[model samples]
Target: MKVFIPLLLGSFIFIGGLKEGFVFLFSLLFLLSLVAMIIGLIRPSLLKFSNRISAMKVLFPVFLASFLIVLITTDPVEEPRTDQETVQEDAVEQKETEETENAEEQSEEQKNKNEDENAAESKNKDNREEIHNEEKENANEESDSSSVNKQEEKQQNNTENKNDSKTLDEKESDPSNDESTNESTDSESDKRPSNETKGTTATVTRIVDGDTIGINLNGTIESVRLLLVDTPETVHPSLPVQAFGPEASSFAKKTLSGKKVQVEYDGPKRDKYGRLLAYLWVDGKNFNEMLLREGLARLAYVYDPPYTHMSSFTKAQSEAVNAKRGIWSIEGYVQSDGFNAVESETETKQSNNSSTASTETKTSGSSAYNGPYNPQGKDRNCGDFDRQKNAQAFFEAAGGPEQDPHRLDRDGDGAVCESLS
Candidate 1:
């Protein structure tokens, strides 16, 4: 009875477990069945009637049990579209993750690329600096070489000058010179003349500044600075040195810096200093004239004939002086206090005093002019007249009139400045 009760309870529990899809109960049942078969084989008395079923009778029940087992154990076949959709969702999620990882990788790659570019730029900058340093070194070397060449040339010229001087001294000392027999007097004269002629044109070279220049005119090397006209100083180390200095220097440089200038002999070809005397010319423009015109230089008219343009130059200087343009802009500039000042002020007075004086003058002329000068009135026309005078010139120019509320027709009664009405 106890065994039967246990068997009944176990079977009920097994069936209940199968309903819940529990595999443990089914496995327990299978194990129990195997044990029962083994016991039945070992001892036939152990087999129960319930367990020993007829084959034909059990076939349908076995088939139903098989069908139920299959129904419970086998997974349901899902529709192809639904399965595909789930797979695609998972695939899409994986793809998104992959994309995110790829994006991160790409960002890292771009960052590395930027770092590489920056490093390359830095390397290139360093290389450029090195190249610049090398170029500067080369330039310094070239400059040194040029300086050495110049020194060598200067030494050579000095040696030649010394030799020439010695030859001249020897010739002067001995009157019965060897050249008298060897060379004809005409030939000597011709040679000397040719040498002098060559010296004149050959010595003149190039102008360096407004004042000075190298020349190869007259078979000898010479330099002449200009005379009379004082140009402003350039090449100063300190700034704010002179107001018009650069302008003056530039003007001078532009006028005469480079040219085969004709030196109109001022006094001697040079002063006691042995420089050339000349008014410089580039093209047809005279340096002196330019300096005067630009107000950079004054016509230093101490001498005549040479100072022929003195009057014209002085006139230009006066205009610059009057306008107070360049040098004349300095404080306390002088001007002639003549009829010019009086007439100019009369035309344009800076004060209301002139306006008052004009009215008083008009009052003295005629008392019947009871118009603009009626200062004792407090009417709207009077206020309007004042406003019109303040705003428009036409009203003030003609003197105000009475009976106009707008007071716009202060001039010529019916006219309103340039307004047609």
Candidate 2:
């Protein structure tokens, strides 16, 4: 009965171990119990030790309890998965991985595309700005060209008119008859004021500045300040030579010096300075309008309203402002009262510094006067220097022929103080 009981318990444990994948100790215990059962059944003398002990009497019952315990504690083996279910799970995981990879690639491509679009937009913006600047420059050039053509045409017409007037005068002065006609004309002319005569032909004796001139009107020399125009002060009593001042003076000298101009008086004939206020027409072109169109002067001294040619003068100034010519080129330079000379002086100083630096290396060994020759300094005269060479050096240094700030080169010739020893 002991052997049978132990054998039955061992079989149960071995089956439980195999089914549940138990530890090695359980397998070993099952093998040992089977051997002991077989030995006791084959040899009766081997069962003598178990019979001598009272504990051995309950060994069958213990074996029965052990078999029941093993049966209760053991877990059932799970069924294996089918091939189709395993393949389906693998396919699902692969699909999810592919979707994630595709999403990442798409995000990277979108980022790159946005960056390229932004770069292209920036490039297009720069190209547009460049084109706009080019258009502005072309428009300014065209305006300047048009003004030059008009001036040329007016000059040609003036020449023809002058020739016709000369022919008429020659025919009238034939010294044959018309004494009574001449006496009637003289009596009619005596009724008008000589100094305030309108449309008087005068020879420009000297160009005082941009907007002022000395004219010989009927054998009388008079200082005429152009009406309705004010240029930058090159020779103001209180103001230092402002920016574009020298250029304005140079333009006047080049165009109106020694030329015949028709002086037309307005309501006010004289200014506070006792200078004649008139509109000078040079070669049939309004000289005041020319100065304003070139940006060399501003429309000013308009104390009297409803003046003739006011609309045309405003249009000329508008063109200059649009083109940013001369005084208009400097921001905030032209003010309501006058020009702001501070910025002009600063620019002049910077320009002079650069010019000096460039010429320093070239004039290092030259015999030219190395002394200070400030063009913007106090007015100098031919008597300021002792010798002709010294005067010439100073004049050239002070921009002599182009800019005679000191009036050293009186005749517009390159030489200065020519009579000096």
Candidate 3:
């Protein structure tokens, strides 16, 4: 019974170890126990003691209980997979890997396209800015060009106006037409003085001298000699520059140059030299009287009768004479005929004495009835007399043919004051 019990436990243990996938050591232990049980059954005397009734009976039940406990606690093994199912799973994994690769490629391509678009947009923006700046620069350049053109046109117009004014002056002063007009006017003025007191407006274009200016009369530039006033000979052809001449010219330039004035006509319209004879009024004040009042001019050229402003001009001259200003400052400088070039008595004596013998010889034949003639008095010139016959009479009285002290006959023709009307 003991041997049978041990043998049954070993068989159940070995089968349970293999079926439950237990360790090889448990199978080896089951085999060893089975061998031992067989040996014990076969040789009972080897296991028993001298006094033992049966040792197997005591150990066999314990071994059977241990094997039963091990068998009850073990789990069953799982079944293995088939080859076809494994192949299908590998195919599904490969397809998923390919889809993931395609998605990544699409994302990379979209990123590159976005970068290209952004680059193109930035380039376009830069181009637009450059074009806008260029346009602005061009506009500024055009504006500058337009301004330059306008300035040039304005300058050109001013130049043209000046040239036109000059041309008109030249045409009016032409010698061809002036001689006939002056001759006719001189004859008429000598017969009867014109009472034309009507005034006209004119602009002074240039200061010709202290008592003369070039005026723009209705777009025509005419040389205007201030009526009833004579400044020092600054621009005379045959005379030297007299004292205070430049001062008088400077005063005229300051007072009348570039100024609009009123031109009041007197007895004559023009002089023998074709210069217009008019009284200049500046700001409602008589410029001619102003010159005399300032001592820049002397009241002279009273050849014609009935001068309108003669009284006023004489008053202005009296003021300057009383003040002893300008020409009046010099003693014996202002005279009846004209200004004396020499102020020294010695020079005057030398001049008078040098021609004395010749003067006596020439005056012996002249029948002088006497129209204010003084041989040994103040110097006389052609400007002192009103007519040519009067000057001739004075020249004859002063022995002009042999010795001309006053130098009335500039051409040495023995015809005194031929320039006079």
Clashes of each: 16, 0, 0
Residue-wise lDDT of candidate 1 within 1-421, one digit each (tens)? 9799678667766776654434444545555555555555555455543444433243334445555665687568876678889899999999999999999999999999999999999999999999999999999999998797566555544543232111212433665543343243333222211222212332235433344544555455555656455443322111112335446655555554445545444443453234565555445445565665566544342322444333344444544555655545544221221011221232223223434554554345344334443332222232343343232433333333321222344232344433331
| Backbone clash pairs in model 2 (N, Cα, C under 3 Å; residues 3+ apart or in different chains), count | 0
Please list the residue runs of candidate 3 whose C-alpha ends up more than 4 Å from where it truly belongs after superposition: 1-198, 343-421
Task: Judge candidate 2 at residue 10 and give its lDDT.
Answer: 68
Alpha-carbon deviation at 197 in model 3, angstroms: 4.2
Q: Write the per-residue lDDT of candidate 3 for residues 102-202, one digit (tens) a residue.
A: 99999999999999999999999999999999999999999998787566555544543232111112424565434454444443322322224436788
Q: Which runs of model 2 end up more than 4 angstroms from their true locations? A: 1-198, 344-346, 350-421
Q: Deviation in angstroms for 300 in model 1?
A: 3.1
TM-score to true structure, per model: 0.27, 0.38, 0.36
How well does candidate 3 match the true structure in TM-score terms? 0.36
For model 3, state the Cα shift of residue 118 in Å.
99
TM-score of candidate 2 to 2 decimals: 0.38
lDDT of 2 by residue, 1-421 (tens): 9899667666765885654434333444455555555555555357554442433343444445545555665567788989998899899999999999999999999999999999999999999999999999999999998786566455544543332111112323654323543444444322322334447899988776898787888987787889888788765423556777768888998999889988988755665445688888777678887898899998776665666666566656766877989988888787666777556566678545544543442244234556554444677776677789887877666554544556665544478778998
Worst 10 residues of 1 by lDDT: 334-343
Say which candidate scores most in lDDT: 2
Local distance difference test, candidate 1: 0.46
Off by over 4 Å in 1: 1-209, 235-241, 301-306, 332-421
